[model samples]
Target: MEAKKVALVMVDISGYTHFIRAQKVSAIHAEEIVFELLEAVIDRAEYPLTLNKLEGDAVFLYAEIGDNNLARVTRDVAKQVQGFFEAFYDRARTLTEERAECGCDACSRVHDLRLKVLLHSGEAVFRQIRQFEELAGEDVIAIHRLLKNDIPAREYILMTDAFHNLAGNLAGMAYTPSQQTYPDLGTLQIHVFQPSN
Candidate 1:
């Protein structure tokens, strides 16, 4: 089987569990907020980047490198990332105002949620099982391992060096070099880009 290069993106909600537990929010209300936020992110995704699946408080997206130029792909991914955050913050504000008088725990704390993204570009083996398309390879494992990083910021985009090398310098963005050791994946260098609101 021929291996193909693909970009992997994961948009995850931080403070989800802590918010629920600390606020003592109901499961139903928590689920509603999470679902709504995840849906907003999904709605912002553009072509070439397909939604792989929804993983709890995160959305997994993947796009085949194909013949598209790196500049075009980078711009597209950056746009999608920007769009998701814009929609996410907008929705949070709207929910906050709508529930200002409700006094419900979930409604009162919806704005506490934060968004972060993990990006990596590498080779993968694609397999189609029933209705789902899955990407499998060491790269896939590496991207997931990035989620367990010790970044100080709550909201930031962390990209693997491989991705940064291809995406180049994103406009209006500054990246800080960082590294973390994963028990299984060893030590990997990463770049963190924190977008200003």
Candidate 2:
């Protein structure tokens, strides 16, 4: 199949490593909490934007960009990104209240968990072999590589120049200029939108 232009996104649970590294008895509850948080984020995904796969503490998603739906899909995804954060925190808050009686490390530390989103626009070649589907390309690698960066924050929305151009105003959100450098990819110009909280 021919490669297609698409918007790639990843919603990651920050501070998950520390939260999940509890004792064996508490690990089960930690996993359950992570599962709940992940479910909340996944539930916010809408049409045009599909779940490509789950990467441990993160969800990888993509939306194809075509002439007919370019504007609509970009706008829809931009709004959907915002919705992910809202759903995540709302669910987290509810979980915190419900689990307050419990003294497990995972339950007590729910507030430490944060959400980070990464958006990149690029071309990808998608393939399916039986039930297993995979996306491969330089862009795909770049988006995944972005997960490990010097962002200096646990929660924020980071978008590549390509994605920022397509996503437009992003509901009139303000973003600051930032850059990430890798040995191979060099420097990537990114725009970061951080919550006021």
Candidate 3:
């Protein structure tokens, strides 16, 4: 399909590598817990925000922007991004309580798993390869690259300036302006929002 403006989102589990490595003996339970958390986030995704794929510890999603639905789409994506935190943490809390008696490292340390979301708006070309739909473009690369930022928070929402312009102030969030520079992608100005528990 032709390139079109799309809002991209990724909900990633923080400290995932450490958690898996630290709980090798309980790897099955750890994987199961991660799957549950991902399901919670996926359940919270509404229309317009389509699940592109599950990237191990992260969920890659995208919503196409139409000329007449820019405002509505932005609002929906923003709300969905915010809701992901609640969905993930709520499931985490329930798992922790349910497995409280279990001494497995995965059960005991579920609290360490945090969710971080990245948002970006840009152009992308969509293609269907048999059963899989793929999004390809510079924006897609940029959004994925954003997952490796130096944000000092365990859980937070990071949005590119392009997305900020489309979504406005995101209802109640007060974003802190920040910048990230990659050797290849150059500089990216971003807004960070760390939600309160």
The digit string of per-residue lDDT tens for model 2 on 95-172 reads 999999998888888889999999998899989878967888988999999999988988988998878877776655
Top candidate on lDDT is 3
Error of 3 at 114 (Å): 0.5
lDDT of 3 by residue, 1-197 (tens): 67888999989999999999999899999999999999999999988999999999999999999888876797789888888888998999999999999999999999999999999998899988999999998999999999999989888899899888888776677679999998889999999987866
CA lDDT of every candidate: 0.83, 0.87, 0.91
Model 2, runs deviating above 4 Å: none
User: Model 1 reaches what TM-score against the true structure?
Assistant: 0.92
Q: Considering every candidate listed, which one attains the maximal TM-score?
A: 3
Best-to-worst ranking by lDDT: 3, 2, 1
Q: In terms of TM-score, which candidate is stronger, 2 or 3? A: 3
- The C-alpha TM-scores of every prediction are 0.92, 0.94, 0.96
**What's the CA error at residue 48 for candidate 1, in Å?**
1.3
Clashing pairs in 3: none
